[model samples]
Target: MAEKCANVNDSDCSPAKKVKLNDEDAIENTDERNTSENDATPETELNLSNFKVTKVLQNNCVRKSICIKGTFEDREGLAVVLLEQKSFPHDESILEKGFFDEKTLFRKHFTNDIYRNYDCFPTEEYNSIQTTVIYPATQNHIEKYKRHELYMIDETYELYQQVTLPYIESKSLSLEWITNILEHKAEQESIIYEDSDKDTGFVLITDFKWDKQLDTLKLLALPFQKIKSLRELNASHLPLLRNIRDAGTTAISKKFNIPASQLRIYFHYQPSYYYLHVHFCYLMFEAPGIYVAKAHLLSTVISNLELMSDYYTKAVLSYVVFKDSPLYEKFKSRGALETSTCETLDCK
Candidate 1:
């Protein structure tokens, strides 16, 4: 199994120094936290009320595989990637079966590699070797990520290099950072909406004539998680969405808290490119009576689809946007979606 690392606030500490905390120590720490919460003092809350700790200590955090090493020809199709830690809120219960809480511990390494980062830890199959690390549950910065793509660990390093496969450890952004970043982006550019005009409801419904032959395209909402290109979207008779300055799922979810049902998603095809436009009502989750509406743009699926003569397939990628949320802040920085380019309020 791979080696585990400790979680510590290292801003003031030296780089090479390492702190060791065994499983017993970790369990004791958890117990201590539980005990403190049980007899919580009001003054302790006051001490942390103003001072927010951005850095999380790595302990029982989850690791995600962002990039996989090796090609289909190398490992017969098995991809290799790295793992990084994730921190959750202390109050949230760590359940046995759920998303993001199942994985714990390291397994065996692939033939030539030293460490293996599996999707889930402690499974009977891959019990060779693995590494697990956790972080303190307070850090919530989104844009501070290390991996943009799975193979592209270093922002400065290109991912075109070939490497041995079998065992893999991905180098991606911490799950804490990814979650916060996505949440932050959603909060910022998501369109705000209001239900004040339920009497004068939407009228543009019957215009969309569904064509059976055009392919039943179920366009998924935006902020494409691991998808890097349009080909990966796997939509038929449609195109991928890109240039997500004001369009993305994260942006919409953060802004309104309403599902994608709140927006009008459409497809447009140009001679050279395809477009997806998401029209939404800009209503703040906090201010339900007030209504806000906006339209966001998405770019072509493939930058150079004209060059492909063989003609593989097509798909549509839908983007949803909301206003003023945590996701808004994160996307504003990543250039995924922004509020500055939105049209003026027409509901006035």
Candidate 2:
């Protein structure tokens, strides 16, 4: 059984403990073996020597691999390695089960500390280390939104059209932003992919905030249509998801040289802008707004629409709002929300 840390927020936990695995077992299980003194084969030792350890996690029995190291390889781009103690149990290893095997373990043990800064393993040799992007959602929060707040989404849609849509139309804002990107005024270096079409095309640009480290590829999908957020999504809008996923995945794969399975494509509710756009990020990069309260996987959205043509029309969606958000104010005014703090609202 995995042991729980007393306080995950604490910085001074005990150093990762070392245990002894049988030498024969270590040699036989090369794929699951750790890059430690006890388990490192000649080839593994040579390859890992090039990297330098940069971070360590202590007093975390559940975390066998606490040290993370990185170095730029001559041909392999950036190579990152997680150093694990040889004595840890192979059966209990999160990597052996799958990246998202246990939601609580993934969130509490894997996401909190040193792992946040390290890149997902650079090569198959380091596959024993797994990471995930989705945050764990509390059952209470999900149930509360489902029961009381989902209906407000419909009201929020009307508010968006009345207030936000006019501002966007008057300024011709998103179009101008796209023009700036094409003209090289913004995000020139970050343009990983572009599908130019005057009719139904879109551009994929790197988000300005992404640092490009740790597989944090934050690409924005700006569609040609001025559709405003998921509220505008319906059967007709479903095709946009396919086009963006197909094109975005291909481009990102070419750029990163990774399979499409390593990527996560989704959209956020109450996007910063009113324009309809999508987000393309690595599955291991925990970019903001990825919680269940706000993020909706594009694939799920498409399937929902396929099952019900007017899915968005009748479906109750849950979204989060900050205390000062105008949308939150709208819900509060209508007596749909009791508080202005960051809370989830359900809209139908």
Candidate 3:
């Protein structure tokens, strides 16, 4: 569930402070059998076994792990133990070498496999796999939006700074995934479209989405800088859009052995992420977010910006908000949307 940011200026908008654990209690609970040869005694051995199960995390159907509270002896502060389900039995050798040390554990465990899987597979092979299947929006969702306006241009950047930025900085989900893609997968896999240069401008990468089961190619045009949604775009970003379209068309067509005309390039108003990105999918595929109220075609966006420099900036664009969305409530408070009659769907 997403948390609502009541005020952007408040300290509540900042990342949540992590709780500190007592190190002495944790060290005292270390099992004697797990102690290293060099430090077998209680005084010498670093006790790590005194962990209290704080949370259980489940990833897909295949794996689950416990998040434990503890502190490493050598480390200055308290830490959390993310116990990953190992394929092999607990290895004492790893413990002796400090493999599960705070720093090492953080580096290894704090990542999503959905993003990391791109690194393991060849780009062509990865692109071919059907990883996601999105269901069409229900009548409930349709009716809820019917009463409320979708795009709140004025609130876009404010919501990003308050809600999105803090989550990325503290939770390290989308931000980390993006960093890994740029660092590990982009260049080697031909995913990079334009590297940010002083002359040409902002960095952009074009890559196929993990889900492409529709028997047609779908690509993503992601910008490196933090620009929240299409609402933030203006004439200044025209070059970036053009580059993305040109580069994306060439890359997708060549890789999939299809013509560029078959592709439909567009942008979603209320994107899943705050970062500005364009979507390129097969024209034949009735993609989930392509409706008039939700999607704005890239060609149209570019043309609009060209005609009026502050078109998006000043324009009152319409976009959908579900009955359950906090944004929906916000709109209701401002009387931008009528009180909804449709029931909120079980979103998760």
Q: Which numbered prediction scores highest in lDDT against the true structure?
A: 2
Ranking of candidates on lDDT, top first:
2, 3, 1
- In model 1, which runs have C-alpha deviations exceeding 4 angstroms? 1-158, 161-169, 172-220, 223-297, 306-348
lDDT of 3 by residue, 1-348 (tens): 112211110001112111121111111000001211333466544345433333221121222222223345454443343332222214476443444334332223345756432222222312222221111222322232222223333344445455434543442113343544435432223242344433222223333222323343455655656576787788888887776676666655545655678888888766655556778777876545677667889999999999998787567666656554556655565555654344335444
**Best prediction by TM-score:** 2
- Residue 12 miss distance in model 3 (angstroms): 50
Off by over 4 Å in 3: 1-173, 185-214, 341-348
* Candidate 2 lDDT over residue span 1-348, tens digit each: 344331111111112211111111111101111222443366443444344433332233443333232343422333333333332223446445433243223223346644553333322332443321101122222221121223224334455566445544553223455555545455444555565554446766666434334365566777776676686688887666777777777766665665678877887765554567788777877665676767888889899989988777666666655443445555667666666244456634
Task: Return the TM-score for candidate 1, rounded to 2 decimals.
Answer: 0.19
Predicted structure 2, TM vs. truth? 0.49
Q: What's the true lDDT of residue 21 in model 3?
A: 18
- For model 1, the run of ten residues with the poorest summed lDDT: 23-32
Q: Estimate every model's Cα lDDT from 0 to 1.
A: 0.25, 0.50, 0.46
Predictions: Cα RMSD each: 25.9, 18.1, 18.5
Cα lDDT, model 3, residue 309: 84
lDDT comparison, 2 vs 3, better candidate: 2
Q: Which tens-of-lDDT digit does each residue in 178-256 have in candidate 1?
A: 2322243311111122111222111110011111111111112223233323322333312323223222333334432
